[model samples]
Target: MKYFMFLIFVLLFFDAKGQCCLHTDLSRKFDYKVIRLDHKDADGFARESKIIIELYKKSDKKLFQKIQFKTEGIGLSNVFSKCSDDRSYITGQNMKTEILDGDYGDIVIADFNFDGKEDFAIKYNIPADVGPEYCYFIQGDKGFKKDEYLSNQMLWFPWLINSKKHQLISIVSPNWGTRIYKFQYNVFSKKWRKIGNRFFRHDEGLDEELIRLKNI
Candidate 1:
């Protein structure tokens, strides 16, 4: 799924690198390729193309295309007004956001609270006319409820993936000029805390990653 991003970034960059704006044709490699549609922001294209590719990959084609995208960390929005900083994790940066899972696009089905059955953490698209995207944690029965988070703009960009421990990891963006956020399962605490403010690829220990981010 991570490689899914290369589709938009690489594709778009390819076009930009071209001198004349000749009608760009998809130069097929026979093997699946990553193509980014634009330079500044490929959210619109990413949102659409990613779903088709992922759906085809999961249901019909290979689980992951020839060039598998290494899933990145989750980008979270700062939902709290009092919290300050005012930033939400951006999703489209690493991967695209669209509903390949039918109703849930960038969502994970798991027992986030650890009660057993399973809960959910999903990113929502603030209406096309609204501000940036927002993420929510829905507990059993209660369903999708809004929380005070980090993201303010309505870019609604996020990607959900099951990690090595079968834990759901999300690579999300809160707002413009912000890095990604990694939310990990605190086995002992039984809750999700934003780890490694803006992360790139997967890391074994979140604590170590956070320290690295801080040092940088």
Candidate 2:
């Protein structure tokens, strides 16, 4: 019995500390790639990861630009299993990069700051209780600069981009009802501001309803 228990404990120890590392493509724009490294602490919690972005130009095969950032723990958002008596649970969260094929285009491209040039909208699943938040890269003469304005804004999951109007819409339900918030870029202030909102039923799709109502 003692040997059997020891073997089980050893297995769990390694299983909890499993690691993953890779470099993957994120967009078709000049073939941007992300280098991701995910590590877990001894207790099996996601510690942090290094995410680096590399953009290359095909003609010369030259690395044009690079961006790097570190991930911070967003805290536990999920509970997989719970102990009946104590209610302790196993939770998991990671700041991993999105896997992309040749044509899966989830990235939003728009002139968010109304500069007449295209900018990229990327979502990051930061430490959050609900869903993923968003950030953007504004196109510049050299490459792109991270927009601090949108990065500091607070928004929640189930989000969509309005490319025509340069808007970001998000929906959240804390309790029994849902609240919708629409954010638009203010060129003068160089920030995003909430422009509109509405309450809707769970059955209705927030993205679809927002598009319809905003058109009217």
Candidate 3:
């Protein structure tokens, strides 16, 4: 009886449902589901080092698709650019897809373009002192396409998505205190532009400002 019960429990666990999460934002909200995966490429490497994702409708989980391209891995600095001499950074294919840490990142599903259909963003939590790398994909009738406008940007660290105003928020520190920049997204041009700016000390709460902007 003990063995039989264990078998039944295992079956129920596997049969319950696949792991997935949904986005609950306002401006670019959609009813889509996300399945995040941290995979290791079997290229004779000892460590598991890659990220894969699946997106599908919440109502119909069976119909889902995987991300087409391999991630360029978590960056140490600006892997896209070399600041010392302003030269481009080139790396081998294997290094590009390796995982930086156990927590690969998250898969966010929403309508980033104000369209009714949903879009997806892979926020790679790079194992650096700075923020993570971002990759956005716009959904179409057939499948998703990489948004070059967003991909080319050197946005690092964590960022917040404001659905009501369609803005992306980030805090920057110069020689003085910290400055908050509210970047609004332009769907037609597929770019981000600063709309609001504020300065605060290290002790001030930046999140409070983010919440306050939703009303304006």
lDDT tens digits by residue: candidate 3, 136-173: 77778777887775555524322455667677665555
lDDT of each: 0.32, 0.50, 0.47
Candidate 3 at 104: error in angstroms?
12
Candidates 1 and 3, the one with greater TM-score: 3
The lDDT ranking, best first, is 2, 3, 1
How does each model score on TM-score? 0.29, 0.58, 0.49
Of the candidates numbered 2 and 3, which has the greater lDDT value? 2
The per-prediction CA RMSD against the true structure, in angstroms, equals 15.8, 12.7, 13.0
Give the per-residue lDDT digits (tens) of candidate 2, residues 1-216. Answer: 553354356445534533111112323345444444455678966566554556665455467788766545422322111111010001111113242211112234455566766565544444333444545677888888987766665334225556567677666654455677778876566668878777867635756775685674
lDDT pick, better of 1 and 2 = 2
Model 3 accuracy (lDDT, Cα): 0.47
Off by over 4 Å in 2: 1-29, 74-111, 114-116, 126-129, 154-160, 197-211
